[model samples]
Target: GAGVSQSPSNKVTEKGKDVELRCDPISGHTALYWYRQSLGQGLEFLIYFQGNSAPDKSGLPSDRFSAERTGGSVSTLTIQRTQQEDSAVYLCASSNGQLTNEKLFFGSGTQLSVL
Candidate 1:
């Protein structure tokens, strides 16, 4: 794909259910990030994966949320024990993994609704 691709543009899950969101970044991009935007709130950084180095997960809100990049190409974000407060738009972005490369390609987020 020319740009990032995300699956299940919209998802509605029960409060106790779990959900997994997927993202496929642009080819050759070595840096991938996950973010979420809740109503009336700015984008919140969730996790970051750069090449083979350890992922930066300091931004994750809780232990219930986890993400992983497979083979440095695709990524998945899993939310366990979903809560109403978890409803938001989950976005994925990718970069070239160079400090000089400031541009990022973003995918249209997956809208999550926890009932």
Candidate 2:
């Protein structure tokens, strides 16, 4: 893809079910990040992967939330045992540089609905 791509634009699941969201970054980009956005809320950083460096998982809310970037191209975010509060838009972004000043290209995101 020419830019960040996210799969399953929308997802609805039961409260106890799990969900996986996929992200594919643009070619040659090395930095990837996952974020969550609730209704009328700002984006909340979830995780970040940069080059061969260890992923920064400091933003994950709990152990149930996890993400992995494979081969520096694709990434997946998994939410285990979802709760109603977990319903939100999962966004993925990628950048060419690891520095905070770099510009990021974001995906359309997957809207998760837990009932």
Candidate 3:
């Protein structure tokens, strides 16, 4: 892909359902990250994966949130048993291998609204 790609772009679900948001990172990029941004809020780092080194899941808000990256490329973020507080934009980004200070290219994101 020319840039990171995110599926659905928008999702609205009832408060107890589960939703899966997909992300396709730029080719050859070695680091991929998932973030969440609520309405009028800053980006919240959910997880970071780099060539499988024990995925950094520190930022996951709760047990209901999970993510996985396959082949060091595309990734998916799944929110289970969604709640009203979970309504926000699920964003994904990728970089050309990590070294900190490297810019991350973001996707349009899947807007999930839990009503």
Candidate 4:
């Protein structure tokens, strides 16, 4: 894909269900990130992965939310026992991992609706 690609575009699930969102970063980018945007809110950083270093999970909201990147290219975000508060737009972005020239390319987020 020429840019970051996210799956499903939209997802609707019950309050207690689990959901998995996917992201495919631009080929060769070495950094991937996940963010959340709630209704009328700003983007909140969730997780970040760079090269082989341990992922920075500092921004994750709770233990129920987790993410993983495979082969440094594709990533998946899993939310367990979803709550109404979890309804939001899940966004993915990627960059070359060069601090001096870092620029993120974002995907069209997946809008999650928990009822």
TM-score of 2: 0.94
Quickly count the clashes in candidate 1: 0
Clashing pairs in 4: none
Question: lDDT tens digits, residues 1-115, model 1?
Answer: 8999999999999999999999999999999889999999999988888974545899889999988888989999999999999999999999986653468888999999998
| Candidate 3: pairs in clash | none
Error of 4 at 83 (Å): 0.3
The C-alpha local distance difference test score for the whole of candidate 2 amounts to 0.89
Deviation (Å) of 1 in candidate 4? 0.9
RMSD of each: 1.3, 1.3, 1.2, 1.4
Point out the worst 10-residue segment of candidate 3 by lDDT: 94-103
Question: Which scores greater on TM-score, model 1 or model 3?
Answer: 1
> What lDDT does the true structure give each of the candidates?
0.91, 0.89, 0.88, 0.90
Superposition-based RMSD of candidate 4 using all C-alpha atoms, in angstroms: 1.4
Error of 4 at 95 (Å): 0.1
The sequence of per-residue lDDT tens digits that candidate 2 reaches over residues 1-115 is: 7889999999999999989999998888899988889999999998888963446899999999988877878898999999999999999989897685358889999999999
